[model samples]
Target: MTAEQRPPVRGYAKPVVVPERLDSLTGPTTGIVVLPRHLKWSGNSRYDLDQPGRIADLYRTVLNEAATSDDLSRYLDRATLLDLWSSMWLPVALRGKWEDRFPELRHRRYDPAA
Candidate 1:
């Protein structure tokens, strides 16, 4: 498939930063995770993982704002990210970079119209 032209990805200084491996994402699957200052600069920082909507929101925010793969590793779980990828609201650039690096993400469908 051809790539779509869009704005450059932000939050990281380097271009297209993806993890060397996904299994390293061994973060909490439940409970509240209060985001760090660098990750959550504004709004509410605490995310209740038990709540589906809140967790999805948290994943979306973290995925978009993370400065590096380590930031993602610190907050996101591999299973949770795989389960939530299709539903989370994400920027085109952020989503594209991830989907490119991880083909499994491409299989999960996201409908912005929803």
Candidate 2:
């Protein structure tokens, strides 16, 4: 099949941001992420509904919790970032396998970090 006819392919990676600004942020920051237009169902629950993945949510939660705890050191580690990703994606993968088969999705790459 031609590229246009194929299903969409999307990707998302955690942003590498400095620890300074993650604190002192007042609200949910606007950011980009990849997600399928259709959500997959696993058992009785559903995966993300065309929204940010759990990884992004976890990143935000970590920032919020860290700010309160005054523990900026934790967010600096890439392994911690990856752990957040793993925690987020495992459910998606399982849902995809059983329900949607991990259909290719849409993606856009933002370079704010650059």
Candidate 3:
């Protein structure tokens, strides 16, 4: 599946504040309780949920940086970043020649078409 079609990574729980003691063997005194793996919130960023192709482009760009061992910040020229992000999402805007063709995918809900 294309990166756009692939499911985003999401396997973590919401943090919950609580009181306990870890050193005392009781656990946190008042911090948070992370839930088990099966029950958790999707870890996707708001941007990713709202814009998958942008997120995909970010992932691709980061991978490129790691491949070259280059500092990502150095390459963050305003135009370059915007170009990559904008190009990556161009497909979403051009999908199906309009909205009616893919009614099911138009709503939010993290769909790539959205």
Candidate 3 local lDDT, 1-114, one digit each (tens):
233554543331322211121121121212223322232233432233134354344433332322221223322233333334333432332322212332332342244564
Q: Rate the local accuracy (lDDT) of all candidates.
A: 0.79, 0.32, 0.30
Give all TM-scores, in the order shown: 0.80, 0.20, 0.21
lDDT of 2: 0.32
1-114: candidate 2 lDDT, tens digit per residue: 333454544442322223343233332223333322221112322223236564455354443333232333432234434334333433322223212311221111123565
Q: Point out where model 3 deviates above 4 Å.
A: 1-70, 89-114
Provide the lowest-lDDT 10-residue window in model 1. Answer: 1-10
User: Which residue pairs in model 1 clash with each other?
Assistant: none
Q: What does the lDDT read for residue 1 in candidate 1?
A: 35
What are the candidates' C-alpha RMSDs?
A: 3.6, 16.2, 18.8
Judging by lDDT against the true structure, name the best candidate.
Answer: 1
**Residue 38 local lDDT, model 2:** 24
Better of 1 and 2 by lDDT: 1
- Candidate 2: segments with Cα more than 4 A from true spot: 1-52, 67-109, 112-114
Per-residue lDDT of 61 in model 2: 41
lDDT of 1: 0.79
